[model samples]
Target: MMTDTDITSPVMDGMGPHGTKVGLLRVLGPAHVWALGVGIVLVGEYMGWNFAVGKGGAYAALIACWFAGILYTCVAMIDSEVTSTVAAAGGQYTQAKHIVGPLMAFNVGLYLVFAYTMLEAANAITAGYLFSVVATMTGHTGDLDQRPFIILVIMFLAWLNYRGVLATLTFNLVITAIAFVAILVLFLSTSGILGGGLMEHAALFEGHELPYGWIGVLAAMHFGLWYYLGIEGTTQAAEEVRSPARALPFGTLAGIMTLLIAATLTWYICSGVLPWEYLGDGVNGSVAPLFDTARLSGSNGLVWLLGFGTLFATLASANGCINDASRAWFAMGRDKYLPGWFGAVHPKYRTPYRSIVFLVPIALIFALGAPLDQVITFSILSGLLEYTFMPLNIIMFRKKWPLNSIKRGYEHPFHPLPALTLLTLCGITFFAVFLGYGTQLVAMIGFYIVVSLWFHFWRYRFVNRGTQFTMPWPKPQGY
Candidate 1:
């Protein structure tokens, strides 16, 4: 255990010798923090969230959006508090290792790596398809295989991560801002502000707005996850932020606000213009709902704008996913949860260069190997598992540390209430996922179970106990 002499701050002072040899560069600010979280989640507004429209109806999708908005509010609150305190690369994984236990930490870290990696794959595939969709929309489509597009996108984004975090996330910030403005512009255009309104709500929702009913809304909650899946990823930047206390809470809170607004506006604009059947009619709903809505407006300018938004949003999402996934993998490796070799940071770039390179092919394989909707489902399921652990992590955090044991950057109010709300929402969303993708859900759980067994039997034996609890905090109440 660390003494007061061991650590004067929350940064991992007890990282042992491995971290001393190399370390992540601390050069990020609140803007980068916002970029990392918003860049990863804004793609949902462009394409993925419409899958919920397919499961329920337009109305059901809207309800699910509000429901998920609440759930993720809790996510933001809890994560902001914990991340402010931990200030580590592993985010919740690091939090779990310190407050929960080794096994739970292992699973949480896997959840981070797999969830973001799968999201990265989905983003690559979507970016590829965005080009093809626009080609056909413009009357110039013969047969765009999208394979090369997917491969190139993945390789380019991985290269960005390989270079440096600042360059990678700076690119994300620019593109993410553009994509967000496109949504805002679309909403304003349709709100009777640009000479005349374009949306015909009466025409779009004529007796078919809620065809599937309440149960459908319940089922729709699964895809509702798309609206805010990676917003919690803001926490992953805790380790690198110039000031974790200020940056984590402020950036994450700002990010969630941005998403909530974008989600509401996207839904209102799309529901007003597009038919429910058209928006939700596919394996995973409309691939480019914003672009399609732009097409319906009969404005070539808006079409080009939203189309670019779709493409840029996907690239940004993939870029942020690589950033977050590599950090999680690198953190696990630093403590021998996976392999010690991956823990090494690049001496020149000071990034987790090894882990970043290793995840590239894994991203490509999942991108090429699965259908877009299936890949998204995989990402969401893995994301859900980590969220189910959130309330527990926070509860244990409060009990173990109580208040005032250490200097916290931020503290969430109505603590147990947020915890209970998060747990209940996660339960409801899990049921929603089960209703739609029961087989995949079961298979995912089974996969985790198998990995858990492996970790217990084999991987746990190699974990360096001294390196795991590297957080510089006083001993817990019970311990």
Candidate 2:
């Protein structure tokens, strides 16, 4: 239905031929991108991941984590290549637009918006819950609802994002450092409890390791994915990076490697000290698992420190998600995929103020209304759906635009192998989610149907009628 002219036409409102109309400043470097990548999902290192222990026990969960880690590594490699080549704000949405089509790009953009905003909501709620826990520990909690506190946290972070990316990322770097230090402290303190060796603890895991067997391991894949879930979001800031070609790969790789080590230590040490059942039980599914591990050292000071550290970690994740999601929405709006107002950049701050404002209320509603598990399930499904299409994007991009023509700052090793590997892992994970979480899958389907209808009836007909979906960067001359 669409042609090459329709795909490459520049219908961006208020934009010049050189593609600098949106008013986003390039202020981020490799270090800032790395911090944003790590900060966006740092809470996973402290909490939420322990829920996998319930599905597969400690050992099974650990194995599932290993598999998920490999999936992310492959995805990161391919993404870095694409990000360097494209250097766009919307990340995968931009890739989908160029390689696939506008419809597919629309879907990917919506999926990412849902994923990041829902994640932000989840992190905000988790921060509120952690604050309540600390308050309780101090014997000052009567009836902490947490919804109001969550809203307050969201507003605060949104204000920070509205200020500027520099202040936002600098805050991210500081909190991320503190959060990593807290995680290291917990890992070190719990080492003695686990007899100082993961293998030694595994040897004694007859009752601990494979309680639920292969089925449990299969079910835990989703939770295991939580560890490195949002690292790819770093590419969302490509337009704001000083040199995306260099920064995208370095920042994303650094973030993923850091998460890998943290995930290994957190899972092994926490599982060794506490029963897997205890770690992943009840409504919140052990919201403060790392803090619980810290309790093994019998240090009240350490417990309180970790608890506050968990709060800050959640704040950082929520903040980064807001930053990434707003940019995606702004990119879509700039391309006329949504309302024109969403495309507007703040004259003073030069940030996507409209999109940031739009997302806050939605995040607040989700944070207050949805259960923690459901929120996380929805977020994971959205993320997996976005990831599923990425390899295809890479393949199609290469088919259309040969490597010899375009300049690439970084290239993935083995070419298509990494992309193929990512596809296989994504397929397996989707199958697992379908088999394990049927209700959630149905809910996701229902949500998709609603979004599809809105796009068809409203967005397509009203918003994007004559708009041309073009890449922000230049193409090869022959093409």
Candidate 3:
């Protein structure tokens, strides 16, 4: 008889009907795991992004994040189920392969590559921007543009992740501490605004009156949508954690809830002090909205803390992105979709060493050259795609096949409806971003989707031809 904790046990890593071992490790805990998920939601930059969405945008953000949280909270629950069922390393792509088909899985694999890789770059570049923000606030703003600093930040982050998870967790703890303090300082100095006074004095939209239209709502959502981008990422680490059946869903929901509280408070506070009109300038506006808010609010010390916190936050998120992205790459490589090099795990670290190395240069170029708006756009594209597909997989699995046989601790209160609602909302959000940003961005994204599909059929299909990719279909179809 095999023991439960045995690494090779079918109960732990699980086995296909054909008895192939899908090696996976269970190595994470609740606090650290929850921290990773929540951290992405409370990014310090939202203070500015929320403010620009006009006066009403704050309320809209609150509703949006709250509802989005509820929707993705379900997504997390469903993802936890999939995590436990497959217990394999590939995560979303694994489920995509099972539910949709191999070709579709290959497409998801490609999309995950695009999404996470760009996310890594976005984190690094945002860190660099925060660096300049802090420097400027402390009167140290230099002549250099942010690209070089972004490159350096990306390199450092890659090194930290390359070291190991323990080191990465330690770094996360420190950065989270720093971010908490920055938030505390902002609360203290701007406490006056916290007691609903800002709401009491919130001026009507007088400056450059664009008439609060759908454009304003979409712009706000585009920026605010960043808050909820990586909601399911923590669940990807469920296998790496203890009692994931309990911990994964709890951590996922708890993480989003915590960030919702923290982020809402921070956004409201910042708006209370600086107001939205002043936050949107032409030149300086695009760059340092939070720093400017602190200055205008006469809370320079608090502003400095936020600046440093943002730098740290950006780096931490960047590191997490590298970890997730590289793993995704490794997973795909193992499936023989990408080049064989990506599957080569590091001997010492036991991580995706080759994938990380490959990602670094791509990250550097993306970090150093791409503008923030473009980065944000790419992030939106990747994020929304993942968000849409993730929930769809859950619904399809639950309805088509009825995987109720799987043991899942936590579940969304509403079943198929919540998932459907989330998918619809995501579609609407994507359309809104496309309209607000204009056709050029849409065309570029469209071109990317087209090319990615072509690559999947023409390139990856040929590569994985001999390997029979099995998907669990409905009884009428075939499992």
Top candidate on TM-score is 1
lDDT of 1 by residue, 1-479 (tens): 32332122434532444555556777889999999999999999998898888889998999999999999999999998888878788888888998999999999999999999999999998888877877787798498899999999999999889999889989999999999999999888877887579878778788886788889999999999899999999988776778888999999999999999999999999988888877886544456889888888888888899999999999999999999999999988888999889888888988889999999999999999988778999999999999999999999999998876776778899989999998999999999998978999999999999999999999999987866777767779987
Steric collisions counted per model: 0, 0, 2
Identify the leading candidate in terms of lDDT: 1
lDDT of 3 at 369: 74
What does the lDDT come to for candidate 3?
0.60
Which portions of model 1 miss their true places by more than 4 Å?
1-17, 137-141, 282-285
Specify the poorest-scoring 10-residue window by lDDT in model 1: 1-10
The Cα local distance difference test for each model comes to 0.88, 0.80, 0.60
Ranking by lDDT: 1, 2, 3
Clashing pairs in 3: 27-240, 28-240
Better of 1 and 2 by lDDT: 1
